[model samples]
Target: MKMTDLILKYLSIKTEVKIPGFGIFQQKNVPAFYDERLAALLPPAKEFFFTEDFNLKDENFIQFVAKEKNIDINESYAEIAELVNYWKFTLQNKIVLEIPDLGTFYFNDEGNFIFKGKHFSTESPENFGLEELNLSELKNRKSALGKSLENEYKTSRNPFWWLLLIIPVTAIIYLGTQNPELIFGKKSFKNLKKTKTDSVVKSRNLLKDSTKIDSTKSKIPTPKLK
Candidate 1:
């Protein structure tokens, strides 16, 4: 069988297929998640990924190939080596190479090999009829969270409404100080208030007399004081 066919067959049954001096092809599970846009749960699925481990030697792979093909072990090793060398050469010269039913490989800017299509999961009997889940509880939770956030935002945007409670108290205190009679009635005070009022009136009268004298002196005299 061709190298690609053998690899595809091995990976169909086995979770990992190691290529000596190259890399390992292994299946991985994509984690499940809640999709807010769809309001559904996405089921986990299998995917393939490559790990380049040069130090790994897969004696079992060669043995399996040799036994399956009924070929000599030395011949199997030589064939595998030739295939690996061809792939490497193709990647280096053409910058990209595709393996049938396995994945695509290409060289990046640093000349490092990059693998794509590993996430293209194969359809297996296990996931043949899988379905996504629609969860009402999750939808309710999201709705509640949205409402809570909106309420918090509104409170923060117009927080000064709470301060309005103090406005009435402040106005009352100001009015009481400026016009105590409004709240306390006209007879609330008598002796001390009258004395203070008399002192203010006397000071105003003295200020008016002094201002009149200064104004008369500052004016120019008429030809004859009429």
Candidate 2:
């Protein structure tokens, strides 16, 4: 049978059986036999319990099975090894594996493996299970919050900024009102008007001087006209 089929068959078993070095397959409430004499002889036997050691290296057995069944193992060995590694890590702290209807595999904290019946469920709580949160929703919420915060910051600074702007304007107005000449003095627009008026006055004076000169020449009359 295919390894998958074998696993399925093993899973279907209701009783717990040991897969030798791998682990033990069993159901709950099975008879627990104790050897008092043996326990007494070996003090350490008191804590001794049956456990499996299912490691990635155990894929060799699967390969053997594949060869025996004349099935193409091909890349499946590595695949199976990877799968076992995933299970080992994922079920690190768990003591038992509950394969529905197949059986349960148990592993001690120290990495010893054991198998048991499938009737029991060793699933973790809902909260403990893997969670799938919407990262997009979180990103969008953060973006919106960021925009709102930016707007709030601008709004908070607006009053101070306006005050800063108004201060300069007010100072200018005050200075203009206190000393209009300082802004519109002779050096500014009024200076140009005054310059034009001075030019016109000078031209008029020149004209008057020229007219006086002409009258003096006329009064001098040509002395040669006997």
Candidate 1 lDDT, 1-226, residue by residue in tens? 8888888778778888999987898877775666686677766666678887766688778987898799999998999989888877786686688887777887777888888644443465566656677897768889999999999989876859657867988888988999987877798456664468888999999999999999999999669766
Candidate 2 lDDT at 222 equals: 50
Candidate 2 ranges beyond 4 A from true positions? 1-4, 10-50, 54-60, 64-71, 93-97, 105-115, 119-226
Q: Give me the runs in candidate 1 sitting further than 4 Å from their true place.
A: 32-43, 109-111, 119-226
Query: For candidate 2, what is the TM-score?
Result: 0.27
TM-score against native, each model: 0.47, 0.27
List lDDT for all candidates, in order.
0.79, 0.53
**Candidate 2 overall lDDT versus native:** 0.53
Candidate 2, 1-226: lDDT as tens digits: 4444555444345233334234443344322232353331211111112345563134444555456566667655554456456556656756465544454566666676654332222233522433334455568889999999999999878888789889989988987999777666745344343368888999999999999999988885556755
Counting clashing residue pairs in each candidate, in order, gives 0, 13
- The TM-score leader among the candidates is 1
